[model samples]
Target: MRKLITDRRLLFGYILAHLFIFFTFEQEKVFWYIFTATMLILISYSILDETEQRESRKFHLFIGILSGALLYGVFWIGDILIDLLKLPLSNQITALFKLFSPELTWHYLVLFLIIVPGEEIFWRGFIQKKLLTHTNPWTSIVLSTLLYASVQIHSGEFVLILAGLTGGFVWGILYAWKRSIRLVIISHLVFDLLLFWLFPLR
Candidate 1:
């Protein structure tokens, strides 16, 4: 339906972008370069749109920090549970990325800044906002979380997928509670920075 597509345009766009990256690029470095560039462009657009909407900057920043902490806590807990369970599939998924070198570390930094912010805007700011237009806050949160989790299925990492869903839900709630994209972006950036720095793959 036109209405559904209109509401979920950002989500659709993000998925399309990933598909292109997956098929068109064979080299990881090249794929990441294109992906990061795309993310930077999307994030810039989201920021400008927020400014034009005359949203409260201070409120978004405040909520961003709080939501970031909450999401980080959720991710931390999920990671611990995964470890305790010692799920074979999850551990194997993690093992695939165990050879992270310095180059990959630098690439991750770029991903943290660009890809994560872009995804936050698409999933939290755009998709969640659209869902709220037709659904209740809780419904929108859950739908957005599910969609977010779906995106991670390609990662082949169950633990990471679970964390993404939890983080997405928290961001959705925060956005609904405060109605600010800035906060979501701030929180997302902080959470990602910590994750990348503290737990560098390899």
Candidate 2:
């Protein structure tokens, strides 16, 4: 159990935490609070690990920012594709925005900074790393993507799960090749920011 809780296992815990919040709390505000708190915890853990590893903190931070922008670009491209295809998935995304409407100023802050950072730490840094321990690179990628999608399951979230799986695969590949949590984090943040900005909850 102790071995399991190593950064990798903690990431699984983070996913579970989000799933819990999504199902248990009906209010968007409550979910945001839970999300913010979880992100802080994950960030603290990442800082401690980086310190122990004796890596350049500044470098990792830079990677995080750059990766996020790149990922956002990827997301934009995907959005364009979806538009061209005229897929029903776009409607689902729009519905999600409506469900979370009247988002507070602080919510954006938490979403961009804390939530994105925390998720990057867990999925890219922890889960992917852990998966690599017992599996081949490609296997780990698939498993991580599936797990990522599975973790997002909830009522009225089928489209989200599909998107999660697709994004997870891309992010997992980037994380595997670059071994940079920053890249995955940046991609995720950009993807989400665009989604929210363009769609927003009605």
lDDT of each: 0.65, 0.66
Candidate 1: residue 78 lDDT (0-100): 61
TM-scores for all candidates: the values are: 0.73, 0.70
Instruction: Return the clash pairs for model 2, or none.
Output: 68-186, 68-187, 71-187, 97-201, 98-201, 98-202
Clashes of 2: 6
lDDT of 2 by residue, 70-183 (tens): 655665676677778998777876776666533788878878778777777866676667666656778779977887677667535776687788778888887776676766
Candidate 1: C-alpha RMSD to true structure equals: 4.0
Clashing pairs in 1: none
The digit string of per-residue lDDT tens for model 1 on 32-106 reads 666676666655644443322233455566667666766667656665666789857556546535522224766
Top-TM-score candidate index: 1
Model 2 / residue 32 / CA error / Å: 1.3
